[model samples]
Target chain A: MDDMTTKDVQEPYTKHLLHYFDGTSRYVLIKDEEVPFPEGKLIVSRTDLQGIITHCNQAFIEMSGYTEEELIGQPHYILRHPDMPKVAFKDAWDTVGSGVKWHGYVKNLRKDGRYYWVYATIILNIRDGKPVSCTSVRRKPSRTQVDACTALYAKLRQAEEE
Target chain B: MRYVMTVSPDFPPGQIAGWYIFNTWLQRQLGEHIHVELYSDFEAQRKAIREGQIDLIYANPFDAAMLVREEGFTAIAAPLSKPDEAVIAVAVDSPIQQVADLKPGTRIAATDDPDVNLISMIMLEPADLSAQNTQTQTVGTYILVAKQVLQGKADVGFFLKDAFAGLSGMIQRQLRVLVRSEIHVIRHVLLVGPRLRERHGDLWNLLSEMGENDKGRDALKNLGLQGWEMQTQEDTEFMIDLMDTLVN
Candidate 1:
């Protein structure tokens, strides 16, 4: 997967074993930093059916610290934060895959290894009478909402660990 | 104090700015005695219902049916969506003029709601298509699904006639309706929980009259609804059946 380029990643559903840096290293680096999502600005991205990054707006690219070229052919999960519970992603996939739009607060890992929180809505994109890809629109979340999600997510992640 | 809540799960929590504004206006119209709260979180509202904490609740057919069937909630009022039909739409310039023209693997998009999704499922049946044969995306909102169709991301999109009617001019002009379902019932139903019914007898009549006056009319306009009319057993039953069928 490391050697694969844009041409190779374009094929949908190319499952790659994601080795998270936080999980593998002897001493994990934690950048407990927060970047406020610009108010009223939408951060948008589109992924293929298999969750490969297809297109992203400037806000998404800039926030993630990845260039458009770097992001276009990569897996969308590259920006996934470890703090998020697997159940959240599972629910999100099941909901949208079953033809429901899903809304949730997501904490994302940036390219700089810092993290940010967003309230994201994931929807399915269909064309020519078939399911094509999914798009996610995200915005800055309120402090109160984030605090609640933070507590909820911690409980969820702990449950998974047990 | 009486508690009133509304569920629009498609919207994100804390992001329902306009909806919150409209609810606040409705609270004022309902007078100081009634407290109105709009919740976009399904789980939270469902929990409240299970605990018998909520009084009057507004919800989509699926949730309303669940509340009615299991929790002793009564459907009282519902919004009357003019031209209330399920519609399938495609880009105006797309060559696909009919449902039969759609090939296997064609992408169909609609809101994530099961009732709304069922419309597309039923429409695709004429072409001998099922869920497995087609790629379906559940969009978060009707306007987004319409936008997907117009942007060529989705070949087809499904939304109730009222949602299509509410589309922005930019979206409406870019897409054309491919087909429409027969008339359907109201999308959202207002229900009074047992606790509310026990305390507030005949509250339905008062709530149903919300659309009759000027302040309520202005609020409804802001909320993008036409009017509230009392629901019938037939209307509630039809919606409940649709919800059950989707579940089973």
Candidate 2:
């Protein structure tokens, strides 16, 4: 096992490691800063097999409040907020699963039970033959705007859980 | 030289009467030798301006405001037309009868253009009407929204009075205006390129000096103008104010 150094794990290079994933063949960098991601801003990552997180940057860990020890073995949904509707995530997965980038707003919960919003750009990672990991970035949301969104997410989550 | 003047598709295109006529009349009156081509849509017109493919333009007030503010274009004149207003509408039999009637959960078919419809909604009335519990689903356009309302697909819709006027009689009959906005000046402004300012000072002078009887009067009339009038930055501050208020 190649131990990836924190410096080596930093962006502008960590993305290259995705090529080492089993059956991984290609990667795409989804870029956008429009909605203010706040915790160092950019979300650069790679994945393998059914949209899994193969590599993420320090910014991702800080924004998500997850230690690398806990994040490595888990799917991204560990951060999913109870307030978020499963359908939104379903749609996001379905979209990227089809091998295209989808741009939209997402409501997520932090490790502390606090909620955050992100203007997300999700891309499909295709290996030589299959999907591996899915990655995302989240940022703070404007309080004034998120009230309506929060309410909507509550309803969506209710429907999903039902 | 020949110049193309791009206008919004909100109105008809081509060499029709009203504003375009006035613009043509003004161009000939300036007599520095110029031709004006008219484009009916703002997107196409804006592309022309961005590409430096056109030397002059007659843009919608919002588009003009952006050009003046962002691109440093100079405004030679703006039509005297009153600003276009919008109306939030619901089915005639719907329970929504007033602005206060809207709740947060209400599904409103609105355009994705935040600057125009969404910001305008906030500027016109800044309240958590949605707090009462309603949702706003942004649709592609007002026309699709109108169809949605008619087919009972949406609870409410927002539309410009001018645009709603042209909808089919069947759809028109199904809707009722719940609230109409305060009159806003959606003027058609004539602007010169920034690079042309010094070399075209004489042309601007000609424009500023031309009167109703000037040969350009026909073009001016086509463009829906009475005559050219000079305006300072202060003249357009209200638009900036509206934009700033919405953005903030």
Q: TM-scores, in order shown?
A: 0.52, 0.48
lDDT per residue as tens, model 2, A52-112: 5566666566666567665675556544544456577778777877866665556654443
Number of backbone-clashing residue pairs for each candidate, in the order shown: 13, 47
Q: Per-residue lDDT tens digits of candidate 1, residues B1-248?
A: 65666554643333455566656765565553455555445676677778877777767666776787778887777776632357788998999987667777888887766555665565665454568888887766787898788878888998877677778787888888887765234367777777667544345555577677887677676666687777765457545643443342
State how far residue B18 of model 1 sits from its true place (Å).
7.0
Model 1 error, position B116 (Å):
1.5
**Cα RMSD (Å) between model 1 and the true structure?**
20.9
What is the Cα-based TM-score of model 1? Answer: 0.52
Q: Which regions in candidate 1 have their CA more than 4 angstroms from the true location?
A: A1-162, B2-4, B10-36, B41-48, B51-53, B81-84, B199-202, B232-235, B242-248
C-alpha lDDT values of all predictions: 0.68, 0.55
Listed models, DockQ each = 0.01, 0.01
Give the alpha carbon lDDT tens digit for every residue of B189-230 in model 2: 567776556646666676666553546554555654456666
Per-residue lDDT, model 1, residue B34, is 57
